[model samples]
Target: MSWSDRRHLLRVLVPGLLAASLSGCGFQPMLAPGSPGAALSGRVLVDAPTDRAAFDLVDRLEQRLGRAETPAYRLSYSINLREQGLGVTPEGATTRYNLDGSITYALREIGGDAIVASGRVESFTSWSATGSTLSTLGAEEDARQRLMQILADQIVTRLLAAAP
Candidate 1:
């Protein structure tokens, strides 16, 4: 091939390579299956210290976790999900019109002060406004949902970390 042809080929090939390389990322949005909530029945538990978080956790777990599983293998350890707050903030100066608080939680399989699978995540919920970009309750919900999934994974990591 001529030098010009080789240059042209490289130009075309580079973009194709770039596109393919960028296409495959683990990040993806999950599609819901008719329902809007989930239940717990397997090894995971959302037993909160307070009633409010417990109820909220229940809804979130059901909403995000999908459904409960009455598994045969009893989980050797129990992981707890606790929250720090239940609200969202826009920037820092301005607050949402709706209620705005914070929620922080961790997954810990407590035995001799041992943290099994644990992580801390936060979310924001607000009825700031329809056109208002700040305090988007929808975005807060999304963050909260994903945080639970991450917590589940952290639990697995803790399990593996404890393994001999």
Candidate 2:
């Protein structure tokens, strides 16, 4: 068969196979409207953030898990953040730095105070320090925000995956 015909055939065949396999495996979206994740939504009380990055992290978590209305669980977290120089110039100047961040979180039952789930999530983001001081600071802040979002998403995914 010609290349175009082979490509078209593959396009049809791959999707059919994928669908068959997925259906058999019983894959379910973690955050579907009525899934287990939805049960935790609007029912988790997140701890008050201690800093800007922590605040951003909490904000993103709330965006994913939904804010606590009548809280059934309490989520407490601690964050560790560090910066490491990556790219260096011959003149002994660092041009890029990586912000490494990790968060350890726990979910506890509200009334009984029993721990239900806990885990740590980590990620890193890089920023260029070669720009002006203000621009560099802004870039670093933006990188921190990105890192927080990544970490928060990871935490939510873990929470969804864990048994209730």
Candidate 3:
């Protein structure tokens, strides 16, 4: 067959083959309205946040997974945070810092002793400390919130990927 002919043949045939394979495998979109993972919405109760970073993390998770009206599952999480000086001035003053955050989470069916899923997620954000003290404090708080959002999103993505 000519190159053009083979190109045309593949364009027509590949999609049909993919459709046939997928149709037989019972594939369904995880986050779709009626899919299995959709049932998680409004059904997971996140443990109460103990601090500001935890509060931000729970807020983002609830934004993604929906708040529990009548919880069928429990999400328990613990957060660890560290501040590391990133850049130092020639005079030995810290000019930049990184806020590193990690969260360990577990999901379990309500009233059950077994864990359905569990893992840890880590992220970091940097802030410049060269500015005024108030400005630097604001930047650090913003970085902390951003890190929480990132980690929470990662946890939700993992949950959706593993949802059946």
Model 3 alpha-carbon drift over 4 Å, by segment = 1-29
Clashes of each: 11, 0, 0
* Predicted structure 3: lDDT: 0.91
The segments of candidate 1 whose C-alpha lies over 4 angstroms from its true place after superposition are: 1-41, 66-98, 110-113, 128-164
Please write out the lDDT profile of model 2 over residues 1-164, one tens digit for every residue.
Answer: 89999999999999999989998997777766778877798898999998999899999999999999989999999999999999999999999999999999999999877889999999999999999999999999999999999999999988888847
- Which ten contiguous residues of candidate 3 have the minimum total lDDT? 155-164
lDDT of each: 0.42, 0.92, 0.91
Looking at model 3, residue 101 earns an lDDT score of 86
Question: In model 3, what lDDT does residue 21 have?
Answer: 95
Look at candidate 3 and tell me the lDDT of residue 48.
96
Best by TM-score: 2
Q: What are the per-residue Cα lDDT tens digits for candidate 1 across 71-151?
A: 212222233433333334565443333332333434444244344434343333333333445546565555445544454
Clashing residue pairs, backbone N/CA/C < 3 A, model 2: none
Candidates by lDDT, descending order:
2, 3, 1
